[model samples]
Target: MTTPNQVFEHHELLYVNSNNQPVYEDAMPGVPGIDVQPLFLDPHNGVWVLKVWFHPGVILPRHFHTGAVHMFTISGHWEYVEYPNDPQTDGCYLYEPGGSIHQFMTPETNTKPTETLMVVHGANINFDDDGNYVGILDASEIMVMLDNLIQERGLEPANYITPPQPDHNTKVRNLK
Candidate 1:
């Protein structure tokens, strides 16, 4: 992010919001936070790699990405909707993508808490092109569901605290 043309390095550590609360939960006494850190922002490629952390029993509201959403579960018990290509074929997966619209939930796993690393490209940037909305080809079709997803966007957190831990680089999911 130094310069638009400068080479991006992986060493620079960026800690995104890990502890965030919904507007409605502000008055609550106890509440966990969801934080995200953008590790890489390559202007040259218009790409972003972010590390997302959710406290135990954290449930994320339903939402769709403006751009391609890529994710890899580092550890813990991560769960999501039924992806078209479910690895287990049991209709359960943490890495949900391909514009699948569904409410997602992350629960306490016997393993370490789940840490997801994701790459979302061209999310809010159209610096080049005619500011074209490349998130989806036809906004008309997807726009219909946008309202519902936006309504479910603000989800209150359950009162709880999960200590932050080193971002152990676990294997990322292979999304073709």
Candidate 2:
């Protein structure tokens, strides 16, 4: 018989109260009008979950994800440059496979900012017009950068954004 202590000890779970999370302004440096609130990050596994806000009329330059990305629009709307006609409005969901390149923007026509929840498995490789490797937004790297930003700005780090404990372990749950 399984002991009481083992009944619910198989998996590592995390809950994020976005309302309590700190909204970092211009989280992606050089990317204007963009803010981010990290929900969860597994640096060792290159996984990240974040809430991103894009101000109206804001545009994200061309870039590609090194891993699959799942995005769910929480408010407002946005569209890719390649298919501006097809917009992802609030409540919509999107799954972009790794290696797909695209640029997104919140059209000036949008009356409010766009907010989305994104779960990514790897880094975002940003490229220049000449197709040169310009920069990367890896989850692990972002964590370090954000830590520094918080220290430099004299802001407290959000609990959810903190690194995982050394003893933390993950296990799969069987829903039978």
Candidate 3:
């Protein structure tokens, strides 16, 4: 029979109250009117989850995703420059497969900022209007950016969740 002690051993769950977390204004340097609240970050697997707010008239640079991305629109509206007719509004969920490329923008006519919860894997390769490579955004990059922003703005540290380090014998299995 299995011992009681072995059966009772369990991992602790991580919980985050987003309201208690600090939002970084102008989170992306040079990108005004954008705010971000990091929820979770797993640098080892290049995964990050964020609550992002985009003010009206904001236009993100064109980018290509090297991994799939899932986004849920919580408020307001926004659309991809390549698909103006397919605007993502409140309560909308969008799934973009890896290799997808698009430019994000919020209409100037919007009365309020658009908010979305995004779960991203891998990196976003950004490009300028002329298609010139600009930079890459990933979990590791975000960690650095967020850290710097916190220090520069003199804000409290963010309360984002991160996985615990694995032991030497730990092995991650690919379910797929």
| Best-matching candidate per lDDT | 3
Give candidates' CA RMSD values in order: 15.8, 5.2, 4.8
- Order of models, best lDDT first: 3, 2, 1
CA lDDT scores, all candidates in order: 0.42, 0.84, 0.93
Question: Which tens-of-lDDT digit does each residue in 1-176 have in candidate 3?
Answer: 98564523457778789988888888999889899999999888889999999999999999999999999999999999999999999999999999999999999999999999999999999999999999999998999999999889898999899876655757575556
**Candidate 2: where is the Cα deviation over 4 Å?**
1-13, 161-176
- Name the runs in model 3 displaced over 4 angstroms: 1-11, 170-176
Residue 174 displacement (Å), model 1: 43
Can you write out model 2's per-residue Cα lDDT over 137-170, one digit (the tens) per residue?
8778888878887988888786664454556447
Give the C-alpha lDDT of model 1: 0.42
Ordered from best to worst TM-score, the candidate numbers read: 3, 2, 1
Expressed as tens digits, the lDDT of each residue in 1-176 for candidate 1 is 57464333455444444455222221111224455443444443445565556556665444444456666666544555444233221222344344554434555542334566766544332111343333331222222222233356554432222223335568685556
Candidate 2 TM-score to native: 0.83
* Cα displacement (Å) at residue 67, model 3: 0.6
